[model samples]
Target: MDREFRYTQKDFNRARAFLLQLTGIKLADSKDSLVYSRLVPRLRKLQLEDVRRYVDYLEQHPEEEEHFINALTTNLTSFFREPHHFDILSEFIQRGEVVNRVWCAASSTGEEPYSIAMTLVNVAGGFASSAQVIASDIDSNVLRHASDGIYPLEKVNPLNNKKLFFKRGVGVNAGKARVCAQLRKLLEFQKINLLDEEYPVKAGLDVIFCRNVMIYFDKDTQEKILLKLLSKLRTGGLYIAGHSENFSHFSHLMKPIGRTAYIKL
Candidate 1:
């Protein structure tokens, strides 16, 4: 059957408001096209007339909020994506710095955290036995997938020489790979909303990979989250963000190294 399409302005407004209220992710008027495009499949699957009905159903059923959040949040990521950051991390580990604990604060679908795990395994050459990876995401659905340590084979394509970090599977799981048991053993996945007033973990981390998450928040919100993240980072530890993000305004708390990496001074 052909999918029906009907997205009115009122529907767009309702979805935008509902999403912002629930997740603090602001979807602007200009994003109407994007909103419609992303949610249309959901509407078709649910057999809803348009976006407004979908919003109403979501509001009435609080349990489905997670589904809405997962549908809307962009979780694009890759292993070793910005390889230079891992290079820096390997160098820091080579210097024998205290880095037993690392947090991938915005580890979407496990890529970033898994990438970190692979890097540790390579540099430490079995030294990761003493290390741990805390990988958190706001979306619980994605967190579940991350915890499973499974990914489509294509996602591991960017690992370069790090293919040994994963184990291939076939049959029902064909075209997929799971993080090596050793790497999976070191990773712990949790659901954490970055906008929360207090984060759960109090351990002072030696490094944090919060890349690509702050680009969605406003400047003040970005600073607030960054401050909270910095509080958990040990002195002289590092923080990395998306390549497009800048820390010129935060120079007082963090010193910019090269690229988008920062050191907490």
Candidate 2:
């Protein structure tokens, strides 16, 4: 097949290996096309001739790592992507488990964390409660998008009770909506790379919403990150995982509550 710039298997391997070293994420051989697509823009920006040159440039300029990660990281999510998780969170709060603070480990463009904030507000029967959502992602680009709190209208409209949490856009901003002030105020976005030895979050969080992101990591890396995440949760605090990810093998550390939701032991 013809392409815009020279790309080869070795180039893909080196790029993916560097990605794994920086982010603890694994890309399969099937991801070759994806690697090509993501890196092509970088090649153009740097006036490079091929993927190999981009890889070498990355090696020499450590600061380029941020743009490299931002370009490749996927942030496909929506409000209440897995609706059941929010129900579980509501239940966790209702049971008086002290859900005054929560963490969204992969907040991706804001939907999940905003959903979290909405749930907390609804559970409290209003916005009067003192609760906060610590939203984080390794991808700085998505973090900025999340912080801006603007999204297409179609994405916001399908959500139940959206009027309570979102403001429809107008004029030049039509066909989009912004998360309401109440919901936006409850969140604090941060850039956090899961591969780091120590996270900056406080210990004893009330709930952690670290969903599908773990699927990108190998088993050992998954386990290592899970333990570090659990250490942040208070005993009996809620831990929610994506439907595609399961932690039943680690039952000794968590009690299965509902679906992929767990109560940290």
Candidate 3:
């Protein structure tokens, strides 16, 4: 069959439904162009001219689901993406009110969790001695990269010549920075799907960095996840989200003390 290169409204609807079923990301009709733009590379890579054929191939090959998810998911994150949250975290640690197990719920590619580790190391005084950073993501591929603890120099641009926390190297694998063994020792990366059952952590966390991840879920799912996170948060713990995300709906459960940052009451 000659693959249909051009996408129609039907194709857009089908793709949207498939993605929604697979990842719960709602793609509105207006996003048809965006979907086409993102999926075109996948089509080209597979050498398939038709979107329908690509969809069919995906249905038969379940393992390729992750590739589709990675292609569609927007992972715009950075070390200390929102600096104020880290400031709040530093303050929380100074209060000395709880255990220091920090969970970076959507630790895409490790920057956020690593940033948390660096902040705690810088400001926690003796608290860093006991602090543990757990970084988790649903995407195994990104989690592997995070666990490796190596990043392109550009990715760590926010470090701002702070060579104390990282070691710069140049050889056959030149132009890359790696987290020093001391810093990497403080981090643990795992593959976690938040949409599944409430995550089980061995210890109650002092801070939950669920940043920028809840925006993808529907209102009900967001509330459900928020409640689950709250359950794991020790009293006086902090829960941080993306700048664009708010817990106004769950204001009863969390007290907002700063911009996009919340404290469990």
Best of the candidates, lDDT: 2
**Poorest stretch of ten by lDDT in candidate 1:** 1-10
Best by TM-score: 2
Could you tell me every candidate's TM-score relative to the true structure? 0.91, 0.98, 0.88
C-alpha lDDT of candidate 3 relative to the true structure:
0.80
- Which should have the higher lDDT, number 1 or number 2? 2
Model 1 clashing-pair count: 0
Pairs that clash in candidate 3:
none
lDDT (Cα, tens digit) per residue for candidate 1, span 168-252:
8789999898887778988888788888889898658999999888888778888888999999999999888888889878899
The regions of model 2 sitting more than 4 angstroms off are none
Candidate 2 per-residue C-alpha lDDT over 1-265 given as tens digits, one digit per residue, 9 for 90 to 100: 6998999999999999999999998999999999999988889999999998999999999999999999889899988889999999988878777788899998899999998999898889999978889999999999999999999988988887888988998999999999989889999989999888999999989999999899999999999999999999999899999998899999999999888999998
Residue 168, candidate 3: C-alpha displacement in angstroms:
0.8
Better of 1 and 3 by lDDT: 1
Off by over 4 Å in 3: 1-4, 125-128, 155-161
Residue 101 CA displacement from its true place in model 1, Å? 1.1
lDDT by residue for model 3 (175-258), tens: 778888878888888777787675867646888989887878887878787888889888778889888888876777888989
Each prediction's RMSD to truth: 2.4, 0.8, 2.9
Full candidate order by lDDT, most accurate first:
2, 1, 3
> Candidate 3, after superposition: displacement of residue 49 in Å?
3.6
